[model samples]
Target: MTQAFDIIIVGAGMVGAALATGLGQQGIRVGLIDKAVPADFDAHASPDIRVSALSAGSERYLQSLGAWPALVAMRATPYRRLAVWDETPHPLSRLLPGSLTEVEFNAAQLGADHLGHIVENSVTQNALWQTAQAQPDVTLMTGQGLTSLEQSPDCARVTLEDGTELSAQLIVGADGAMSQVRTLAGIGVTRDQYQQQAMVISVRYLGPPEDITWQGFFPSGPRAFLPLHGAGDQHPDETWGSLVWYDSPARLAELKALSDAQLMAEIGKSFPDRLPHLTHIDAKASFPIARQHAKHYFLNRVVLAGDAAHTINPLAGQGVNLGFQDAQCLQGLLKEARRSGDDLANPRWLGQYEQQRRPANRRMMLAMDLFYHLFSNQIPPVHLARNLGLGAARALPFARNRVARYAMGLDEQLPGPVQQILHRLPGLNRI
Candidate 1:
């Protein structure tokens, strides 16, 4: 059988599902394809191991799509402060005569109630899926995998594993880091695998939920704590959270082999002193870290979004936020194209999307690379410089607010006219 739609999106993860819902709500026909449908979200169930730090800008986008409410109703942990510091005792600190190795940002300082939320990836995906499925112009193709993809001058076609074919004016690749749509479209990626692997564990804390999220940097890597909402109607006193430990692959493997009790002991020793006492561990997993960017965001009648186009180090928790931003940018361009009666697959339109997003994404990638290198090294000079820099950042409130706003994705949410004006200014796109 064959199906036709205005646009067909491959991969129904958070970004893909958000794109589908956003377009469908605008009355554009959208076909959403995924290999497996996510199981129904239960508020009382244990949270998924995978979670995302969703910024305020992402929350606004989801609110517009009617997904935010569902997510909030299910469960979302709002963090009002972010604390980061280096635990390394730099020899230069003695010479510098001051300890400035710590920085913190509070929502109150930014005139916002909360900086962001920590939600399970599955919860957000399920909410977006429900929103998309409820839309009249959206078609869901669950339990179906893409077999092959071909693009003509006028349209893109994708073959399904079950022998079904679907055609659309444009095909969006949101299939993630190993994007099948991007590969079949002949798109190539530039990838750099960091030597470190990240260990993620979901745990329940005996104390009250924290309003702050923190990362303490060590020579090996940063150890992060992200608070998660407690299951069911429990109060903040009964909270859960996630722990991320980054280290070399061999070290991570060694840690992974420890029994749960031994692992808990290791965590207690390695993490910052302020981390909450972990009463129970719900789940644990690990994966290598890498930075990947598609050589081109689009080609012919196909385009890419989210992890399909770029994947960055999770040190700052911006990977999924960047994906959501991609969806927002592409959705606007497509809507404008539709209103103007232009071909949805026009190269010019896709080019514009790429032109706007690629530089911004590239700048973020570079910043993360800089951070990864500066913090993960044991060089004495680098350590001294980083400590001084952190101290300087703490003393500069104006600069700190700007950085906090940028981190929260507010810079990308500026009015279109203002954004265009800023984009024309050299180096402004990155902020």
Candidate 2:
């Protein structure tokens, strides 16, 4: 039997599930397919090692999809302050004050209640899954993997591993960076792997949950801190936090081999002094970082969103936020398409989506890559230049706030100066 839908979205992760929910709310028949279901939330379990910093704009989008309340009910930590500073030591560093070397954004100063929320990836996925499932127009095909994809002049179709066939006016590839749907749809990506790999550690600290998150940049890479929820009665007076240590593969491998106690000691010595006293190591994992962008956002009846479209450095915690932006953009376009009584795969709307999103995604990728390259370089001139840049940002409040607002998705355009910098960056035409 053939299952028909207005659209079939592959990969029911954050972006796909949210899209399904949004489209369903508009009365669009959607098939949300994924091989694995999000794990049920458990209050007593340790925090998921994989987490994302959801920006305020992303919060509003999720709230519109009816997932934010469920996420808060499960667990979400809002950070009112975000700080980034240069930690690399140099003989010239003694000349500058600590305040000049660091730039912090406060919610109060920005006229916002909180900057963003640090959420476990599982909790977010589960919340979106629940919201998606509640949509009467959405059919969630979980535990079924996509095996094949086919497209005709009229529509696109996909086959599951169990031989169940589904057809829709459009097939969306939201499966992620290594997207099978992307491959099946014949889209290619340009990928550049970074020298440093990020190792994330989930641990409990001896303090209440924190309202701030910070990252210290080094020659190797940036080490970051994201505060999670508090520990339960089993460990009274403790809170959970996530730490990211980015370094060479060999160095992270050595740290990964250490016992819990040994790793904790090493973390104390290596991470910024501001890290709270960690009480227990719950889980740890590491993966290589890369900048990837799809050559095209759509091909014929198949379209891409989220990680399927692009992936950027995780330094700023903007990956999932970008994905959410993609979902929101595509959802709006699809709604417009339905209103016009056009095929959901109409290139007119899909082209507009790519046109609006590509530059935005590319700009973010370049910005992150700029930070990655600038901070990772050890050349004295580069180091001094970056420090001066940070100092200038702190010294100039208006420009600093403008950049911050752009990053927070509160502003649509990157400031003129920043846009010019991105434009002049080498190899700008390629990415």
Candidate 3:
């Protein structure tokens, strides 16, 4: 069988689904394809090992798509405060108290209802799937993986593994970091894998749901906490949350081999004292970290979005937020293209999309690299400089808040000085 639409999106994950819903709502015909559908949300199940700290701007985008309410109903933890600090100890550290080096951003201080929400990846995918499926102009084809991609000067077409064919004026690849569509389209990526591997642990702690998420950086990497929902009646006094331990592959492998109880003990000893008393460990998984960017955002009649185009260091939980921003930009551009009666894959429009998104994505990748390199070392001068930097951020409220607003997605462009600093960083321009 064959299907045709204005656009066909491969990979119905959060970003792809969002794009489908947004475009469909605009009365554009869209075909959303995926290998398999996301599992339904199970309220009684343990929290998914994967979660995203969605920023305010992402929230607004979801609201516009009419998915935020469904996501909240399914389960989204709103955290009002976020904290980061240096956990590396040194002789010079004695000069600075913990308060001086620790930085925290509060919604109250920023006059916002909340900083952001901690949402499971599955929950987000499910909510977006429902919204996308509801769009009258959207056709969703699940359990259909892309097997071949062929693009002509006029349009693009993809063949699924089941022998089904779909064609469109333009094709979007949102299949993630290891994007098959990108590979088949002959798009290459420059990838640099970090030495650190992040192991995400889903655990239940003895407390109500927290309003804060925090990360304490060490020479090894970062030990962070993201709050989840309550543990339910099964454990009345407990709340679920996630812990992230970033370290070398060998160290993480050793940690993973330990029994749950042993891992819990290690976490209690190693994590910051601010971490609540963990009562149970529900899940643990680890993966290597990398910074990857596609050589081009588009070629011929095909384009890329989300992790397919770029994957940054996850130290700040900004990956999906960047993906959301990509969908928004591409959606707006496609709408403009449709109104102008231009080809959906017209270079004029895709070029603008690349011009607008590439720099912003590159800037974030550079920022993460700066932090990864700055904190993952023990040089006396560098160590002292980072702590002093944190202290300076605390001392300079206006500057600190401006940066915070940018991070929180409350502001669009970063402050001029910060962007200039990121742009000037050595070798960052190439990415």
Candidate 4:
């Protein structure tokens, strides 16, 4: 038997699950399909290597979907300050004789308690999954991979490997970069792979949990530190943090192959002196850096969201945050369509989503690309220019606060529907 739903979402990652739960809460029938459900989160488990810096906007939206509190109860670390510095020496710096180039942003300057939260991807996904499972309008089909997808003017149809068939007025491609739904829809993506690989290590440190995150740029790339919450209240002494080292693939491999002691020593030698001392390496992994943008967000009755729509460089840690913004924008549009009794798959409505998000995402991608090329260059002139810019930015408190607010995803004027949703959410009217 072919089950019918108002919408079928492919992939149950954080973004997909958020969209599903939002729609289901509105009384729209939602079919959420994923290859596998996230395993239960253990309070005592080591921190996951994959993490995202979620902005205030994302926090509000998740709270609206009833997932934020669960995530906080699981594990969430708030970062109140951000520091970026370039340690490279230039002829100008030697002549002028000043402190090393560094810029800092403080949440207190903006009257906010935190600029953002660094959260494990799995924890957020599991929280959203719980919300989805509790909604009567949501039907989750787990362990079922997509085998075929067919879309027509009236509806989109999908077949799963487990022999289950489903149809919906619209099909959402919330899958990651290698999205099957996007492929089947004949949408192509423009991709650029950075030669650098990010080596991520989770470590147990001796210091108390910190509220600041920092990054230092070298000729190779940037080394970043992200603070994480402890396992639970019972283990207050067990503090954790993540280290991101960006470099050529070969260098990453060499680093990854080091013994735990050797790797810890290497980190101490290479990273800035301000980085905390690590007592233990809990986990380690590496992934290539790449930027990908879909040629189109939607075609016919099919559409894309999250990584399926675009993937950005992780240098600024905005990858998943962008995905959440995509979900927020698309959910607003779809909600309006459902309320008006219009075809949810209407090309005009889908085009609006594409038009609204594509350019914004492209701008961010290009900004990161600019940063990658500019800061990665070691020429004396380039170094001097960047340092000067950083020094100037450090002196401009108003501009720094503006940029910090933008990074927190508060600069954008929320759309009408999204604003209404936020207003209805208790304690989020100001967000």
The C-alpha lDDT values of all candidates are 0.81, 0.85, 0.86, 0.80
- lDDT of model 1 at residue 203? 90
Off by over 4 Å in 4: 95-100, 231-236, 373-376, 380-431
| Per-residue C-alpha lDDT of model 1 across residues 339-362, encoded as one tens digit per residue | 999999887788999999998787
Quote each prediction's TM-score: 0.89, 0.94, 0.94, 0.89
lDDT of 1 at 188: 92
Candidate with the greatest lDDT versus the true structure = 3
lDDT of 3 at 277: 93
Ordered from best to worst lDDT, the candidate numbers read: 3, 2, 1, 4
List model 2 lDDT by residue over 236-320, tens digit each: 8999999999999999999999999999999999989999999999889998888899999999999999999998889888888
**Candidate 1 to truth, TM:** 0.89
Model 2, poorest ten-residue lDDT window? 390-399
lDDT of 1: 0.81
Order of quality (TM-score): 2, 3, 1, 4
What TM-score would you give candidate 3 relative to the actual structure?
0.94
Q: Go through the candidates in order and give the clash count of each.
A: 0, 0, 0, 0
Candidates in order: C-alpha RMSD to true structure: 4.8, 2.5, 2.6, 7.3
Q: Which pairs clash (backbone N, Cα, C closer than 3 Å) in model 3?
A: none
